[model samples]
Target: MSTQVFYFVATLSILFSLMVIFAKNPIHSVLYLILTFFTFTVHYVLLNAQFLAVVNFIVYMGAIMVLFLFVLMLLNLNKDTEPSKSPLIKIVGVIAGGCLIVTLIGSLKAASISSPLILKNPGLGLVENLGKELFGPFLLPFELSSLLLLAAMVGAVLLSKRDEVEA
Candidate 1:
């Protein structure tokens, strides 16, 4: 099934490439090229190169397409063209805001009713003893979780990164 999907996407990619080359209008050609790039992104996914697929989609489809649109002057950048927010959306926003306020008030009340933190054992609260206990029994899990957190932070950094737009 995977191989079949790959073949199908590959054929679509070739068709899009031909459309990009032979299209009469430049805008149509650029749109077809974007479709071709999208198929390439799918190919990256089929190859199990997740990072490469994400990078290709973000770079080629997102940034490069924006560049193409700007180059072709195909986008309307005027603020006057923007549509006003709908009344239903405004009502939904108000309801969501009210829900958040109620949640916050409930949480604050519950926290005030709760007992304050007080370490029952004096020895266990000490830095030296705490370190001993952590490194003694919980070392593996502690290290593994820290490593996992580090990996997540790195992935977040990579995802949020953007190429600089030069004037």
Candidate 2:
């Protein structure tokens, strides 16, 4: 029963993700992305990671999707404004996509599962366990990511700053 449901949701996730890429309208693409993120939240829940599920819902579905929608709206993309693609470009794109698919299939075939995944700690997804793990062995990487985020924030602010024109 659980396996069936997992596969069903996984199928939905894949469908929605493809929709995100193929949708003509940016807003529709963002909507599909949100649906994909929702499916990911369901996946986390199914895996019994309640905290991860909640965080995925809040961060990806809520914050990230909202940001994507906001950016799309502000850009006000229109098909009329978009330049037409050349037949040569289309052929190149198709060739590139086929190559990518072949690479992915080759990688998957070569990386056959060696062992079934076994959960070492069922409660690892809990906030307490997550905090301990992050602050313990993962502390350096964690702080480095925070620092990277801080640098990005500063860069955004600097880029957005208006230069004063002295009269």
Worst 10 residues of 2 by lDDT: 158-167
What overall lDDT goes with each candidate model? 0.83, 0.91
TM-scores of the models, in the order given: 0.44, 0.88
Instruction: Give the Cα-based TM-score of candidate 1 against the true structure.
Output: 0.44
In model 2, the runs with Cα more than 4 Å from the true position are: 86-92
Question: Per-residue lDDT for 8-110 in model 1, tens only?
Answer: 9999999999999898666788899999999999997776656667788999999989799778765643445546899999999999999999999998888
- Model 2 Cα lDDT, one tens digit per residue, 1-167: 98999999999999999998999987898899899999999998888888899999999988988988898888898898778999999999999999999999999989966886789997888889989999999999999999999999999998888877731
Please list the residue runs of candidate 1 whose C-alpha ends up more than 4 Å from where it truly belongs after superposition. 74-167
lDDT of 2: 0.91
